[model samples]
Structures are given as C-alpha cells and as structure tokens.
Target: MNSTYANGTVHRYEEIKFVPPSNNHKTEVQSKDVTILPNKNVSARLYLSKISRKNKKFPLFFYIHGGGFCIESTFSSGYDSYLHKLTAQANVLVVSINYRLAPVHPIPAYYDDSWDVMNWDARGKEPWLKQHANFSRVFLAGDSAGANIANNIMVRASEESHFVLSLVGMALLDPYFGNGKPDVLWTYLCPKTNGIDDPRFNLAAHPKILSKLKCSKIFVFTAGKDNLRDRTWTYYETMKKIGWKGELGIKETEGEGHVFHM
Candidate 1:
C-alpha cells in the first residue's frame, strides 16, 4: 500500500479487540455470526433476545459500528456489549454489519458491503431474521463513521425502489460529516471525490436527497465535547429547513466525548 494510505494500519488492529458471539444469560441476548457474502468473507452478527418467543416478532435494528471507517467491527467488544443490552432492553433484533475497511478496499467497498447485507437479509435467507424479525419496522443506526455509512445507505434506499426492507427510522450518533470544507479523512478514504463538498460527506449540500429519505423518522445524537458536535447540529438544521416530511429529533450528551453513549 502507498505510504500515505498506511495511516493507522498497525495501531487499529492492535488496540481494538474482536469479541466472539455470546449467549449471555443475564441479558437473555444470544448472538451468532452469519455469513452475508461468502465470496468477500463479509458477515454480520445477529443479536436477539433468546427468551423472546419465535411466534413474536421484534423490530429489526440494522447497525454499523465506527472506527473512522478504517477500524472496528460488528464483533468489537464495545459494540458487542452495547448491542447486547440494546437487544435485550429494546426488544429488538439487531443485525450488526461487518464491512470491509479502507486503505485496502477503500471508499465504496464498505458502503457496498452494507447495502449488500441489507439486500441479502431482505430475501429471507436467514432463519433468525425470517422468523423473529418484523421487517415492516426496520431501523438503521450507527455511530461516527458508521453513521456516515448509514446516511449514505438511507439516501441510496430512497432513490432505489427495489430495496425490500422497510426502513422506518434512522439514528445517527456523532455522525462523521463535514461542514462544506475539505476533510482530510474523507479524502483519504475516497481519493477521487470532490473533497468534503461531496454529498456523501456533506449531506447539507444536497437538499433534494435529504428530503427524499425513505425513513419517516430520524434521531441525531451528539456529544458536547466531541469535535464533530457542531456538524451534527448543522445536519439537523438543514434537514428541518428543507421541509423534509419526517419527524426529526436531536440530543447532546453534556460533557461527553464522541460516542460516549456507546
């Protein structure tokens, strides 16, 4: 790989540890890994309350994790613990996606992997999803860079009619977006892009796409101490200003760092 793209290559894999699927009795949440794309070695960690009967269906929470789009996984320990509690308490089935990282696969690879996973599950190929998930109440969520991916996916879903899943809501936690300025990280991931002015990084630039989000509701969360906090507020304000026909909400955790809720 080029030296410029070799940023955080070693530290990322060393500091973050992967957590295997677990069947924790305390939370009553059981998780297992299922392959979504065998050819790419891509997979997702499925989390659901084991106590919840198969006859009953729960909202599907499609999640993506964050590590600057270069690190982290659906199996990361932090995400695993957080999702376990979320699945148990919220009574929602979680599909945490593990997308290919950058510097090797680069920009569109991770985005494409996430979209492919959604399409794969919508076909009813997984028994857990088919039997226990309520497809009509699906929600897409992510934190930091994953939030960026979630936003892009939502925009694409709105444009395409064949995405079988019903995405009723989306939640973004400290989403990584730019304020109409050049962003070094985004450019590093997508080398050929038009800097941060690209709609993928700056959603506020494209009012039409923001107005067309397929989901009817959106929740944005930011940490007061996070450097990206202001950008999130800008996104919320832009969404409201566009007269997008969606119920929107935002919250900021006082004195917290990025993604502190997780």
Candidate 2:
C-alpha cells in the first residue's frame, strides 16, 4: 500500500474522499461540518436536529471512523450514511471525527486529534456541542480501528483531569486489537509501538488498563469469522475476571466478518 512508504518519496495516493452530508429534511437530523484542527484542516461532521435542541438535553454520540489509522474518514460515504441514520433513529447528536492517518502522521497523531477534539467538547468550545448536545449521556462508538481509538480515548479520559467527560457508555464494534502476532499493517502504522503488546493495540495484554475505563458500560461486538474475534472476546472475559465494575456486553454473529453491521 502507498501508506506503507516512509521514505521521503511522496506517494500521492489515498486522496481524501467523502460522500456529501445528508440533505433529507424530512428526518429531524441536520448535519454540519466544522474544523477541529485548524493547522491540519482536520474536521468533524456534527449531526444535530431540531429535536435535539428542544431542551438541549439530548444524548451525545461521539464517533470515530476505522481505517487502521491509515485510510477512511468520518465523511466517507459508508460512514456518513451510517451516521446520518444513527443520528435520526437514536435521536442524538453525533460528532464523527476525521483524524490523522499513519505512515505520514505516525502513531499518537490519531489519538492526539481525538483527544484535542474531546477536550474541545468537554470545555464546551464547540458551538454545536455546548448548545444542543447533552454531555451527561455521552457515548463513544466505533468499528475496527475506530474502536481502538475509542478505547484508547476512554482510558485516557479516566486518568486525565483536563478532559471533563461524562462518558456513560462505549460501543466497540469489531475492535482491532490482536491476540498474538501483530498484523504487519499495525506495525507499519504505529512503528513506535511494541507490536501487539502495546496496550493501544491489544488491551488484553494489559489488564490493569481495564479499570481505567470511566464509563458505566462497554458493548463489544465481534464476528465469528473475524481474525480479531478471539482477542476481543478475551478482552470481555478478562474484564469480567478483573471485576470491572462496568456492565459488559458482547455479541457475535456465526458467519460474519469484521464489522458486518456496517
């Protein structure tokens, strides 16, 4: 893949692609985009509706999109479509971010962007978040690499005083953690990490991190045939073993692959 190149040689591939924001006004969900990182031009799409503004007490859904820290974005067609529907059906405002990719931005870049955006929301710096979103019921959700980002974010949120988050729940769909040998792409993207052992890549590798999740519950979904199934299931079991106080939920489909719900 072009993203694997670390040499100075430029690879112009992986151009940013996006599907336009939803335009159907029949549904209550209204969408808008705003920059979270001005220097990098990184942005997040916010889905808020008139109903969400009724009392400014609607649940907040903060979403992270999966691309193995290499590709894809919040605005990608598949992701955008999903968010649009989710916002309406769930009757919540969703903030889906576009973080920096790897082999170009490197490890921690993705995490940093999410962290910054979360803090911005925590401080009520974002107009839409402070105006219409309910912080007390904020839920984090993601698929694959996005789930990894959400998990990492939750861990950091628990220990950091800077981020005043009211995280109520986390939904990780087919998270990208590994059980054994790390995927070559994982190493390629996060070259600074210690392959699969890094807590960021495999949470099971560090059970102590489980206690740091600052949420009431975590929902993990894994498909039977997904290569990462064992690792995710193990994480759920290990969390229970550790007496993680939060309610844990796990779901699996017999013949599905990673993130079949998407």
Candidate 3:
C-alpha cells in the first residue's frame, strides 16, 4: 500500500461533475434532492415511481452507495442511471445517500455521515420520509462498500433505544469484504482500524456484534465470479451462527462479478 494514502490512492479519482436529479429517465419516476446533514453537505436523492406517488405511500428504501468508500457519489452519471432502473423496477420510493467517503475523510467519518443521515430522517426531520415513507417497511440497502455501511448502521440503530424507525430488512449487494487482500483497502479507508481482523471488514470475526443486527428479513446477493464471494457468504453464515432469528436469503449468480446489478 502507498504510504501516502490520500493523494496517491483510488479515493482521489472523483467524478468531474455531479449529474443533477432528473425525471428525464423517460420513466414514471420523479426525483429530487433533500438535505439530511447540512453541516456535512450530505444529502440524498428521493425517487418516487408513479405508483408510489399515486398511492401516497411506499416502502422506504434507503440506499448507501458503493464507491470503495472513496470516489463515487450517488449522483454520479453511472449511479444516476442505475438508480432510475432500480426505482422503476422496485416500485418503491428510494432515498440514496451521498455519504462522505475515505482517504480525504477516512473510516468512521464515512460511517458517521451515513448514520447521521439515517438517524435524522428517521426522526421525521426529512419531509419526504415523514410524509410518504412507511417506517415499518424501511429497508437499508447498498452495494460493495455501501453495503458495509448498511450493515453497520442497522446494528447501531438497534443499540440506540431512541432510534424508533425500525429497519424491517436489508439487501446487501455484492459487498466488498475479506480477511486478506481487501484489508489493504480497509486500512487505507479506515486508518484507525487494526487491519483485516477489524470487525468492520470481517463481520464473521465478531459474532456478538453480528448478533446486534436487528432486521428481520435479510437478503444477500452475490455474484459467483465476484472475488469477494467467500467473504460475503461468510457474513451470511456468521449471521446465522449468531442465532439471529430472521428470514435469511442468499442469491448467487454464476459468471457474474462485483456489483453486477449496476
């Protein structure tokens, strides 16, 4: 790994421009940004499918983006296109966070930003969530490093007695995890952690913490060809081992790689 983690790493490869929220997907979906954490310049875009808008209520799908916790934004061109597809198909009102990333910001900084957004909206501070979101149907979801944040937030929410918006489920998509090679990335992103053995990077390493996850319906999707497949599977198995009483599901698609859903 490079001794100079910030300027010389993958985290510095930022998008040149943030694509504005658009209803131009030519689909029956409307989207706009809502501020969650003003001090951090953190916010999320809300996408409402025609059905959801008409019905005036829908499942709350709060998404954390995957960018190795470094270079990507939910408003990036690729993610914007992908978000359109997700909103159109899921028929759910989706809120994707623009959480702070790593290298420039570092580990728990990324996690803190995400947790703040979730905790804020859940308290009814965000109008979109308060008016139309079904708190009972709330699901925390993400891909790759975003998925990592999703898991962490759920556990933290469970521990906070004041966090009343219950998370019903979580969809972890092609999560970037491991005990070896990816440790370099985690150390670079987190800096404060003790490498691969860190609970954040290796969920299986901490059964007690894994047991803290409160969602009842857990869904994990992994690409068969994804290098992180074994690590993702380990997380699922460990959740079961911890005696987590939930409906657990896993879908592995052969010949696919990381974040293929995008």
Candidate 4:
C-alpha cells in the first residue's frame, strides 16, 4: 500500500485488497461483530467454537490483526478463517480487535484501541464474554505488525498498574520488530517517533523492559527464511540476557517466511 502524508493527513494511492469476514461453513466455529464505538461504527470480531461445553468457560484469546499498522482488519477473511480454526482447536474464546488503520488514523491510534480492548472488563461489559470467557487465563496473540502491538501492550502494562485483566501468556508470531535503522512504514505511521530505535519497535534497546512484562509466560514464533527473523532472534536473546522471570518458548520454522502458518 502506497501513501503520502501532508499537514497531518495522509492519502493512499493504491486500492487495498480486502475480503469481508465470514464463518467457514465446514467449521463448527461461529462468529459475529461486536460494537466497540457505536458513534464511529468501530467494532471487533468474536469467534466461539460450537463444540465447547455448555456451561464451561474457556480461555480468552485476545488477538490483534497484522497489517503494518495500515491495512488489513479483524474483519478480513484471512484473519476470520484463522481465528475460527484457532478458536475451535484451542477451545478458546477469540476476541479479534479491528483497530483503525493508518493513512488516516496512524500508529498510536491503532495501538490505543487495542490497549482499550485488552483492559476492558469484558465479563462486566459483555454477556457472551461473561458466560464463555475465562478472563483469568487471558492470552494475547498476534502476527507480524500485530505482534508488535501485542509486545508494546505488554511493555506498557508492565509500567502501569491500572490494567484490569490478568494475562497468562503472550504469543508473538513472526513479530515485526526492526533492526537499528529508520523504517519507512513505521516512520510514516509514527511521524514523531525517534526512528526505529523507539522502544515500541526495538525492545533490544531497552533490555530491562522485557523483565517487567506483566505476563507469566511468553511464546515467540519466527520463520527462518523471513527478513525479520534476525530481529526476532535479537529480541529472544535480549529476553534471555535480561534474566526475565517469565517462562519463555521460542520456535522457528526452517523453510518458511513471515507468518507462514497463518
């Protein structure tokens, strides 16, 4: 997606390809959109597996969709399909955030909605969540740029005491962390950012930050053939070097490239 920014506004010159969210007919997973901001028509997609026990609550899977802080959405077919299968197989209630995109809203705008969703007392706000979601076992998962958002949320949660949810773990699938250099897409979305070395994009620069993650465990997945592979490795090594108290799991797919599993 190509974009031009000027005077606090951005214009995109390309037509982005997108597929609307839909439930797979063959799967037992059912999904629906829930309103987040009725005035703005902002919403999120919720996925539940029909095979689940009638009265038992399942772990909550709060997911953020990846599109480089620009394109894609929770309503996109790719994400919808993946979350459907994931909800069914993992036996978790999937709450996929559909944050505002860039070329209009920009970086922190996307992050803000995600942070709000993460902090929402869902059990008190939504009936389905109250009945079906086990908030005590909340897990945050995302791929690529979404993973970046997930990590930033974790870091921010580490520094704040007001977060309401208890996160058991976080899963980062081919996170989009960058090396020590300016990134075009990132700099575009975060115009005032201090380049790619900003703590949001470069966790290695802030070694102690990893130790303060609010979660008890973390799982990071990387594709060996991905361009961002080394950056993920750097992040993993930094976590180890900091002697982070949380349990850590790292996995790499030898012949794949960025988010291949998705």
lDDT ranking from best candidate downward: 1, 2, 4, 3
**What stretches of model 1 exceed 4 Å from their correct place?**
1-13
- Steric clash pairs (candidate 3): none
* Runs with alpha carbons beyond 4 Å of true place in candidate 3: 1-11, 14-17, 51-55, 180-182
lDDT of model number 4: 0.81
Q: Can you give the TM-score per candidate against the true fold?
A: 0.94, 0.92, 0.90, 0.91
Please, what are the lDDT tens digits per residue for candidate 2 over residues 130-154?
7777888889999999999999999
Stretches of candidate 4 above 4 Å error? 5-26, 121-123
lDDT of 1 by residue, 86-183 (tens): 98888899999999877778888988999999999888768888888899999999999999999999999989988888999999999999898767
lDDT of each: 0.89, 0.83, 0.80, 0.81
RMSD of each: 2.3, 2.0, 2.7, 2.2
lDDT of 2 at 180: 63
Query: Whose lDDT is greatest here?
Result: 1
Q: Rank the candidates by TM-score, best first.
A: 1, 2, 4, 3
**Ten consecutive residues with minimal summed lDDT in candidate 4?**
12-21
- Best prediction by TM-score: 1
Q: Which ten residues in a row have the lowest lDDT in candidate 3?
A: 1-10
Report the lDDT tens digits of candidate 4 across residue range 1-262: 7555566656655454556556666777778778877654567888876744676788888899887777777876678777888988898888998888886776787778888776663534776687878878888889999999999888887788866677889999999997786677778778798888988898899887777897999999998898889988999999998898889889999999888986
